[model samples]
Target: CNPIAEGILMAHQVDWLRIQAQIKLCEKGRRTGITFAEALDSVITASSQKSAGGMDCFYIGDTKEKGLEFIGYCAKFSRVMAEAQASGVSEIEEFLFEDQDESGNTRHINAYRIRYASGFKIVALSSNPANIRGLQGKVIIDEAAFHRNVSAVLDAATALLIWGGRIVIISTHNGKSNPFNQMANDIRDERYGDSAEVYKATFDDAVANGLYERVCYMAGEVPTADGKEAWYKKIRNAYGPRKSQMREELDAIPRDGNGVCIPGVWVDEAMRPGREVLRLALDADFVHQALYRREAYVNDWIDRELAPVMAELDPELRHFLGMDYARHRDFSIICPMSVDMSRHRDVPFVMEMHKVPTRQQQQILFYILRGLPRFVGAALDATGSGETLAEDTADEFGHNRIHQVKISRAWYGAWMPKFVQLYEDGAITMPKDDNLHQDVRAIETVEGVPMIVKARSQDLKDPDLYRHGDFAGAGALANFATLEVTSGPVAAKSRRPRQGRRITQGYA
Candidate 1:
């Protein structure tokens, strides 16, 4: 439906707009503070841009494809437009525009010539002014969505357009690179005399309204009723087998396509009844996801690393306690552990994971938890390595006969799994919450591998994490847990420094 030639024509029209009298809305006053006649005077003129040297411009961009294109295309197009504008002007005017010409022309304009003709300025650039600081026009990036990264580039281009009439960008979008596609669509939407107020319309409607493609389909003709299918066949006929590539591009980006994603749980529902126990799983280094909530990419731990606990009013179990006994920044964090008489060998699963960054990281968790919800009891490392930074949160928070005891550092590969599957196949159902059920997937394993996982951190004394759609700690309210499985006395190497006569160590 889109045509590159149309881009060419639209680019040309934009160039023409620069020269149009009506479009010349230069609110900026004369830089020389002199009248036109005085500006021509050699003594009165502050400086002659006619020499075309020592000018300043800046551009900024993100890492997205569309952002990348904006900088590249705009830089390319500006020069191309300059050449097109030069067509009608005489050689005398060209020579007058500069002063160092082999042909004795004053308008030689060589400062940007070789670099511009060679088609790259970033390579030619070195050194830095305070504002540009050698990093001016360089891409600046942040996180966004799959295609939101496209907008970052657009933002950068916008900054470039602003500073030197350039752009700047902030972005995110590792999963779906739709932002750039939208950006390209935005450019196409504004093409062919559309200007700023390009009315929203489909490709057929755009062509019908003489938006861009005018000749091939003739103005006012409707696009094929079959939509993309018809467009594909026609492109195939016109561009031969290579048209498949074009059609794939069209398929890759369905303009105005509906995105189908379930909304994630708000932070509070994540703390309600049965949901709790957050896990941090790693897809890659510097790119981990947390399953602390019922949603994929979700988190609900009030404190960063400490897992939550549920205390029931049972008599025999009241004495047992979940003691996470030790910690530091380098090793696995030591979260506030929980214990009760019932949960030993009773946890449905124990999972090990790495945490990612921000609430935005919840996006990935929503995907996994939306379908799997069988997991229970995730003991966490509350030590601030990847969790929050709170001093003795469990101590200040342990009102329900609970405490944030440090787990004496031991081999994780062996002990954690035993703890993880403590209650596997045991009859444990999370207390019901509408939001939790909706966000967590209810699917059991087909090949005998259960998918749902949960951890605890949801009773009281939490940051607003529980209210913020993180439900990993919801299970802490069910007191049928057993945190004190092997607690005669933990005899592992002291994970913490034993300074002054350390006799009673690991006894939180």
Candidate 2:
């Protein structure tokens, strides 16, 4: 190896990254020299003969400028190691390539290419380019977490693996929910069956690997241990109070963004592991049938399923319920929250059901309200298909006891902060469920307002669980209910009379 190339590989992080793996993924700190080291590896691969396992390399970045910068590293590696190579790196060239949009519309792109003395070459590509699907070669996706469609890019990259081409994915996390972070985690957990190699390098890891000393060296100053420590401290201090940013960018910790409605740390802290929790699972068909003939099946369900669970709750504590209604596609999350006002702890009990009829949901909610020792207030989602059920619940419970919440940008903008404050102040506790954790993380800030992602999907085998942020929405509603009942509890209203308002509506 050339001295420059050898020096580049001398970094411990670089050495870890250089291990020969067909599928390589790196969760790295920002501004570390991992990408630079990757460029040297690309040079070595592209400059070697086919008999030596060399292949044409494709470098994809989040932007064309990043492509240029990566190619610049390759150019430097070529210059410093030309005599050592059997097939030397040649001059960089600019060319136009025809690229296509997602809609099959064609456009020309200015791409940078570097040809080695061997038949192999390296090309730099912009993010999410459709033309990548048409290419067959070793793929290097840089800053994958920041790509517009990282999942789609990964799909394209994996296609090349069938032909024995390699794939290298590297980026710091953008959010906890980003596909790149999830894939890296899956690989680390051995979900991919040990074919892939995983590399994790945080800011601290790079610093221990001589990152600060290298910075001093790059600045043309003699590197010292004390000077390196000072530089590291100064860099970390620049991100004060924005701990999520620091964690995501430097610590290699997964963070959705600053606008996430709830901090993942808070959720983790609030989890009551191994605690007894109730989950009532009901299918759509059974719920629908039970609703029409409530005396036959629905009543039995409440007694058999809901009653035992209700009995387990703390009888003395005041309870409030939040219901986000969805009949199909998304789960209807009903969160029953108990507040020990004296202790100032809000313990939320999670109940998620999907594809259940609105009538069964109403019956379930009615039973929950009737069984509670002290029912403060309930907030029911009244958006779109939820309107009828919400209104029915409100009519049954009265305006004093039930709030028919129609969610909007203004609604989330005003109330989400309070919900988040409950988490930040350590006033909330939830059950230990990974799906619920993901729901909390799915809430992102868009244009200074907090909202759940519209197109977000959870990777669950259950199609009903493929919701954006059902639990988060219900959690927010539950928090909102606490604000509605300030002084004391109000009795639920009824249609006929307090006595006649049980399950029978006297309907034909």
Candidate 3:
């Protein structure tokens, strides 16, 4: 229904609405020489149509000429913004340009900070500025909540903008507690009465009041539905009225900023013979590479402090390594971990297990290839540049099982659940080795899901019900039977599984 309107808007040639403002300013000025303040009021009044939505979309224009007129008006207003500077405590204008190109190239843009009387300047931003100065001008930060350093936005703006008496922060957000929404709410509650003119409104608020509806209607910009009705009438009846999800998002944040991701609700990783692996996870950051390194929680701590009293399986099984790759030589890493294990010490023993240089990638891979003589698949973690490297290595060594690794996706769908169940069921055991323990601790769960890999028989469980460790070579031997040659981006292997065949055997 909205396709045609979107198509038209996409092809809109001008900013017509602005042209009207220009004419109004000219006529008003002819009668009474318009002051910058008067011009500011007129511009705000003209632009404040709730119907036009946040940014201009539709207006008085039949052919593309009207669009061009709108563009001219917008440009003119921009010029006014570019000119109008320090007014008696009220900032007249400002503009910010920040975004990526169509091809995903990042662009650095300068902020235009203009004061009517005091000139303007552009400086490189180490961090986004919410306020360049106090009485002169301010800025509206784009994505306030998702920013890693949201505090930076507040510190800059509140220091300058609030003292100046004017501010208009704007954004379309997910919900409350989103830094912007929270700030807006705080302002709404008179928390910042001394600061600025804080008004929080969405595009919908403008549309409902007929302030911007004409433009919105013309452009087909309307609120989206929550989802389709349920298949059963009962389900539909149970479902409540449709609402924007912003409210729901507000409910999840920790009010107390102690860094506890989730409070009170603890995960239950109790003993269950057939479902032991509680969570299988992986993470790239080396700082917290060991899952036990630290978080405000208790997964690894339990394995150390309580695994003995829980499932008591620490040896007798086979352990092998699971590796996800990277493209560049710098990022490519190999972490050697043990399957059928439940402690950090065991992980450190499986040879070299640190994040090493790129030069060692092929050599370590060579050692792995030699150990697991049979064709063992590895995720060639490379997008474009890495792909070349992976292909070259595979060709040079005649190793063709180089699967393009999408580490996150595979773990989410395939590995996590299995890992959790294995932990819960006592399907894994660890040896008395540091490397193995560290690697196991390194395993991070994606969305609370575990990345379960294959293990071999003869797995051992401690009598104390604490640790579990399996022999390393045994795991590779078991997994070795399941592999088949599947080259880059192709379907999983061929007709018959190439069980028990060396990777170099296919040299023909």
Candidate 4:
């Protein structure tokens, strides 16, 4: 006879216990009662005779509190199933677990256990990679994603399967980049063969299987339609603006990855030819050159190269600029965007500089700003060393026309979506260059925020060169400037003669 009543276990819980795979994993939502179901199964297994497929069960949770909770469930279940057993169950026993490593080193760990008359036992041990290596039994890892070393924990747990022992890994997703999520993906791809399987149980799944009603029953309150709706809404509303965290915890969806955000086709569709990508690379000795020499060199290059491009821009169209800054390693990119009557944003050209000194960077930037027709505004990366340049630019161009942006996760969450929307709506056009293409593709949805990934992409033409989404950042900042900066009456150029020493400009 079954010890559990017909409605005692939810559908997902029953399904979890029903899985007989040697290595089964469950990526589940919070408060789904999977742990409770597992506890009942563990008690049954511990009470069963050796001929009836009974063996020892070891539970490893991420926290000490979780261990106590699991053992409590086992104790309760053992008493409930007393009638089915020929012998009585022992009281909960607290003991030191002797964990041994390959080097014959042993360490004592605090553990709680319950022994059955059938010579089988249920043990709940503290979370530690070394704790699972020497155990020979069914291993259950709870909240595997939150473990200190998820990879190590998984590796040790899988070793149990070699000795005819079963392994169960259960957790809600931490992030897509997390090893637990990777393991789950590997399992779905059949990387683990037929011995392992992955199961998912979301909050909605549990609710549909009478979770809310069960909660009501436990609270000694009558369940109602309005009450259920209110309860569900309350739980969701508690997350506030943390929608990604809510989705990950309640929907079993993993957040963040190195996956491409903008597909190549989308980027390609937005690209147009005939756009210029001016580059300036300076030697190490450029910084030590005399000030006048540096100024003269850059000024000459600007007049020759930048002048022609500036002349081609429509004087009537409003323009904006976005800049991503770097000094030595990565390229500092400047993207100038012109908006036509149709509200279409066009990138006239992109400027890239490598190993260029800060003073020359400012000179080139000032010239570009002064040249852009009807310049509305510009956004500059003000993070780290870029702060000084951005602040100086804001001071020179008037604070109203320049935005010093502090690049961060929160900023990306707010602004990156708008930039992405431009591409999706076909409202923006950019240069058709492979490097720029790769830079834009570097954006990834990290923790549900569309931001550039940490990894850098090698320059297609120059393998020695690398980019950290320089153009993409500038583009996003430029787009932000256009949307956020208010367009005021254009200031007329001063007819007064310039004073003081003139800084020369030339290409590096």
Candidate 5:
């Protein structure tokens, strides 16, 4: 039957069927009808002639019940189309499916099948078969995230593409660390080279396309606006207090370990174009040159890049600074935050230094600190090599104004949430840059603490370089400074007491 003309298929279902890619994946919400759409597609494919792209279809669900459900859909659809097409569709046959492994090990799996007159059949395996490569056709893996070995199943599915077979993967997110979520990310990041595509369907997206109405019709209840609202609320409230789980299951957002702490959309919304990200890279030989030469080289860079950006800061606003320090490999990031009357934090500019000597880094940092209008306080990363710089800066600018932060898990637990809160509350804005975007996206939850992950992404501008969330750490520290540091103008302090004699008081 023509489900589309009958309005049986929703927009997302139709859109899914329209994609004829070799490999397509759907990361969807629970009960979004993706499996139902796949069942119809499987029936049509199995009924088509060989010249019209007919082939055997395999449905691999995580459990036996799911297999039965899929096979039932195929049976129903096949019988519906039989009268119109005059095709012979057989009854659902329960039999043993022979599965073989790479080592020639063989086993029998419980399977259900529906044969068609076109010599093609649709088979639903009760479990993930070891010999997926052995059956070549349109392979549909449902609830892929719940599979026993997600990575192994995905790896085997790719082999079907060699024989012009199409593969379809559909599931709701399990977690950020699940291979299913990772695969979706890989496709978005273009790791699959356009061979695979990922389609996302959240609960809200389905409701927008008449999911609630469909539910009402199925339940034989009249649909009303208030009823739909209450239905949505009921479903959301079902997972009360478990916000992460609710978001993952209903919103298609992945949570738990290794899940992205800051989504790209949030980062994109907070990013303000036209802001500057000053970069200074010094050669190894440049550091070995005479001290004056090194000083002059960095000074020129400061004048050309940093001076213009700092000149625009408002003197009336209180400013704070955070620095994540590095000497050679990773970037030493400096983030300066300006707080306005509305309590919004605006990062006027970000400064990144690579392969620069300690003295030069100090020179650039001190310049930015001094140039900042109404500078209140600054936080510096004091871990390892960073200690010397943090200490020196504290000594130069008063201990009360410069905080020496030693980053640790406890520290992250205390401060990272506040940093994340800045973005969540829309209280902060930063420069629009791809490298900075990658840096912020690197923050992931580990053991219940939010911190940067060990795995790094390559810099978009420089292929040879990688980022370890330097900007994110610095931004976090800068945010910490704003909360901890007393807000006001900083009093200038000299290195030494005045050597000259002091004037006597009038009374003396």
Candidate 6:
């Protein structure tokens, strides 16, 4: 029989998530099938007869899109199980549900609900602590960690238990200090008593328990041990050097305690809002086709798009550029920094282009470089996919003005401190972007070296995160240009700092 066509299927930690419990919490890795299983369980709950032990199910996800996705799962499950047609359960419906605030003021919020013939309804609502207040029945809080007020939501969810309804909390941890993580830990420590049950699942756990096989089946491939292992290795290797991100995101470990390299307070102070930001966006096909013929299009893009943005800059200021060339799920980020008379390091422009063709990268980069004021120097990452870009940049910009940096522990140790020092001393300022803030904060001091934690491979379906530190790397390289200009690049022989004198301690 066809697995997916047969109907709702549970495997590995997914099966664990479906276990009957009055109160259940799932602390899981990314794409570990927890939510998928929750959707199936919800279907069963809403479809089963009341006397046979059925109850209404309410799913509150962290975003409106998540709510819709959860509902999509229900729609699919109902179709596969033939519940809607056979049992007369109504199709997914959009409606308004009444909710109340802490002050007891009533309001109506838009919601999606599916009514099963068993007289039980499964409702999916967007994340809002107040929205859950008047809700009764089994509550499933999906991505609980990312919710605005997890503690408050949990408080509201627990109210249903008084009427013998179940509460299911499902989420991947946001950070070690996140309230949801703390609650999961407390429950596991038995602080919530035996009524609380916590299920833990990691990427490795899913893989070991037939995740690859399921994926193969879904993709219509014959499941084989060798094929599964290959798929596993490919996914894991996609993370590259972001192991800490992997641990926190995929291995279900906390990262807040991993020694954050850039403090939030520092990032907050450096963030400059109300600054004009320049951006250039070209069609994917146009960029590819126009690469070799870039002379015509490139000149036009520079005159129209690039030149105007550069015209906003102070011509007297010495501008520097840093490039982190990347592709295939990673963005290629270019950050431009200026040294003002106040000695403040100002980042006036940050350009991030995704999946840009290689030749087009050179054209855009060259145009931007030629348009800069005083164009002192640029630091281009010379590692992996960046090698060709670095080589081309050196040829165009002159070797003295373009530093092709091969990123390494030594390079990170030497340059990252200077970058941190600029922040600590209030000599630097960056444009306001939440992802940029996250990129800086994602840096953690691992064994005295400050670097970005490479999280395990991210799902292609999910939007990209600064988890890879692309922005941070570009910013650091731009900062490195200033360091190189001032001191002619630190000697490659510079060894790690002496023990007890770690860079992290000075700022902490």
lDDT of 3 by residue, 200-306 (tens): 33322322323233334556666233211121232223213312222222122212111211101011111113322222112334333332232212323233322
* Ten contiguous residues with the weakest lDDT in model 4: 494-503
Question: What would the per-residue lDDT of candidate 5 be over residues 121-162, giving only the tens digit for each residue?
Answer: 999998778878887989999988767667899999999999
lDDT of model 5, residue 158: 93
Whole-model alpha-carbon lDDT for candidate 4 = 0.84
Error of 4 at 474 (Å): 28
lDDT at 447, model 5: 73
- lDDT tens digits, residues 50-106, model 4? 899889999988777799999999998888778555467998999998887777788
Lowest lDDT 10-residue stretch of candidate 5: 499-508
lDDT of 2 by residue, 358-448 (tens): 6767767777777665777889999999999888877777777788899999999999888877776778888887777878776777667
TM-score of every candidate relative to the true structure: 0.23, 0.52, 0.29, 0.52, 0.53, 0.59
Superposed by TM-score, candidate 3 places the C-alpha of residue 1 at a distance from the truth, in angstroms, of 23
Overall lDDT per candidate, in order of appearance: 0.27, 0.74, 0.31, 0.84, 0.85, 0.74
lDDT of 6: 0.74
Which candidate would rank higher by lDDT, 3 or 5?
Answer: 5
How many backbone clashes can be found in candidate 2?
Answer: 4
Better of 4 and 6 by lDDT: 4
Error of 2 at 114 (Å): 0.4
Question: How far is 339's C-alpha from truth in model 4 (Å)?
Answer: 54
Best prediction by TM-score = 6
Cα lDDT, model 4, residue 260? 49
Alpha carbon lDDT of residue 103, candidate 6? 87
TM-score: model 1 vs. ground truth = 0.23
